[model samples]
Target: MKRPNIVWISTHDINPDLGCYSGVWPGAEYAVTPHLDRLADDGARFDAAFASAPVCAPARSAIMTGCFPTAIGTMHMRTKAVPPPEVRLLPEYFRAAGYYTTNNVFTDFQVEIPPTVFDDCSPDAHWRNRPDADQPFFAAFHGMATHESQLYLGEEAFAAATAHVPAGARHDPAAAPVPPYYPDTAVFRDAIARYADLIAEMDHWVGGILAELEEDGLAEDTIVVFWSDHGRGMPRAKRWACEAGLREPLIVRWPGRIAPGTVVTDLVHTMDLAPTMLAAAGLPMPSHMHGVPLFDAEGTLAQAPNQYTYAGRDRMDEAEDTSRTVRDPRFRYIRNYHPDRSAMQHTQYPDHLATWSELRRLHSEEAKELAQGLRPDLLTPLQRSLVAASRPAEELYDLAADPHETRNLAGDPGHAADLARLRQTLQTWQGRYGDLGLRPEAEILEGWRPGGRAHTTAPPAVVRSPEGLAADCPTLGSSIAWTTDPPAEEQREPSPLERTAGIPVADGRRWHLYTGPVRADASAAWFRAFRLGFEPSPEVAVNIAQGVDDAQ
Candidate 1:
């Protein structure tokens, strides 16, 4: 009846091209990662694991709470707010059940940790590390080095350490199944290579942690789970609901408890991890968790049930849009909530980065144009055709036939039934979670402001309008104008700026206004104005407009 010690290692922005997953990765096949591969060989490897959402905060939230991101309104990465404290968060559950809980600072939640949640907040420590030999522990370690922005050393390190790759074996653009959205070039190959290298580096980090657990003689008694917050960070990857963005590498290692070398291909989501951990700890599953425990009748681990895993995408990176996907073993279905918006609006690829001097040297001017065809700013004729012609509603892909999700099956007459079934599932889920599809016009800029400040203004009245003014605030005292530029359309009208002022009416109600500037002592004033439903105080307004506005 003793609870097992738990150690979970999570990496940010990793792809499923590791040595255990596939041999096609040039970097992983050549790089050294003896420890991770050994663990996989001796444990379970999940071939069908997926993240509920492809962004960091939402995905982590789902895993931590065993609830769908949509249910809690944290479907977007860092966009939506975090869950309220009343919810039974996974860590608090373990702590309540007599286990020490600790985290190595992965604070991607929308709100700061409340003082009641954890026993410690220091960088190198937490409650699990407290010198209490009698209690079991639940600990999490997050590795941010694998993040795409920080993978500067990845490419060079891969080239240096993976010299064993055959010279001609390097990825060839012509042979590769290049996604229609991206220009097939050495640049893409180099990007993937760099990504592979970062994954290998993460392998080393996981090995080090596992070795430490073993050194402490807790290896056999500990259940270790390795996963990524989401999929790879690339142009179309992070912000989309495609497999590249929504899928993740999930490996569960529980000695004696989980059968070894068992490959479970059934669909499973990140949320399941929380309930499974709780069940392993002998705690009753909370009714609030939407995920089912993946265990056998005798309380040992078992394969997950066969079902469709879901994922959603909302407002991340430079691109702002909404999308959702559902994938079973055979097929994947995607619903793009904003079909008018280009994928590039949600992401910016390195194709525009002038720092890659090799781009100029590798091709002629015409070739450069071809290479930059999918550039966010300049779409090639073919790119424009694809983007403009594609339907805004739905897409279906037979994943077995096209693992990369290249072709859309929704248009075919033969797939109508399949599409209908998936669409029904999607709609049922939306109703269950109360998804409004797109955010209301009034809420679009409700808490939004330029830079890192929250704006305060009267709650705007929203109305759909062909004039382009989607919202009108009472502060304006009348209907204002708003316009949306459609595809192949001209900017024939000015955008409506609903009237807002820094001052508020003497009434007790409060409003938020976008302050163009800020002054000293804005923090206290910000909360006060927010509470009063008035524009932020002059000090807060100045602080937000000009940033803290003074030396610390």
Candidate 2:
């Protein structure tokens, strides 16, 4: 049997707010997501999928490697720690197995984007761009229309984000559902309505992509996967490691291999994606990956499915804090390491949102009401917890009883066993994973960058071989990317993490992932190499013209 081709569509900072998940989430019914609904109808929709982290960089890093972010020292956003030599990326294994891998442009994985992970890592990459029609390909597409910044980055950003939604199709602000964490205000309702528009735009884009696939007559030969990096980009949902933040949409369409309309309620983590895809493609899962495979030819998951999903939060943008959470199907337990710190800390990015400003305004009003000994119903019980000066050391919520996490059951003696079990689970996970977030940031940085300067990967050597030319790097675990074509005057796009990252990200469009040998007479050949988590080597030019050779 032939291995199925894989195509992953990842959306940023979104939740399962599609029309198909009907009663799962309250506001899901309001979304006009015909394309996503059709996808679920054609395949399986996971009812209990969870992200490894509440934020994008950490969660995406975990998904890419199949290892927990904490285990590999990538738990913090824009983490500067380098991975141990043995912790190889998952896509390299795919490429080794003769699969063409491509990433459609988003590579903010906290670590440097390794040079050999994908055959294509630019905005123009797609499954259709594969060289051979028969080769199995793993393609990834990214959508950022629903990102948190889009909602507040001026009216122009909002207009571009929601361009697909017609004026008549816009949702009514009054009809939007309100989460218990926020006070019922017009500002929030309006934001939610606009959020629906963003989802509509995403759905339209997906439709176009699917249409292209069908037009190519490759729909049946491919396995389609659609998922979000995390939950809704709102105050308590996006940054907090709560149920609202961790829960995300997951849909898979594998013809003949998976039954249509299968709704799975297993407690599966998003990290499982790496192992699952590798396993489905008949490849061995690496020993370092912490995720479990959720696929087999029999169309059933492994006998021992996950009973719980775990997540943590560390250094979100400007906020410095530590917290961890573990959840069974019906219960969630959160341990706030920084118990003295307020739940709402000063973060310059999210503070600009209208909803954030409005929530602060109402929180201040409630504080005044409390000082006057006047008990007012302005803030709900759960909403008050978000703006509290300090957080409880431990929190336990029976999600079945209080889905909104309105009440804390940690102090209750009746559920002692549940609390003890979850607490121990969280403890065991932390001990086993060896969370790097516990260490001081300065210490980690010093270890990665000795003398305040990064250690660069050794430049690759271009040698004339029987085949023509082969480039090899001397550094251990380093990957080399080279091109035989002459260099073009392409402008390099800058990355915010470029200067600080352990490995400088290489963003070359024409370079190919170096394998054995290439047929090149050494003329017009250019080479660049990078190790797992260190600075990329400077580009090397070989066999250039006379004037350029003198400069070299």
Local distance difference test, per candidate? 0.60, 0.82
Q: Show how many residue pairs clash in every candidate, following the order shown.
A: 22, 1
lDDT of 2 by residue, 243-304 (tens): 88899999998887788988888889989999898888888888778999987644565643
Candidate 1 lDDT over 1-552, as tens digits, reads 778888888889875656776642222353334566777777777777888888777788788778887766666645434243235457666765666667776656433333223333335643336668767888888877567664344457656543433454444333433455555566656566555555666777788788888777888888888888887766556656887787777888888877777666778887899888888877888777778787632346555464788888876644567888888778888998777776544134433432132233333354566676843434334334332423457889998877766778999999999899898888777777656325652353353333534444344333223432133344321111111211233323312211111111112222222122222223222311221122322222112233323211
- Which ten-residue region of model 1 has the weakest summed lDDT? 497-506
lDDT, candidate 1, at 252: 81
lDDT of 1 at 96: 57
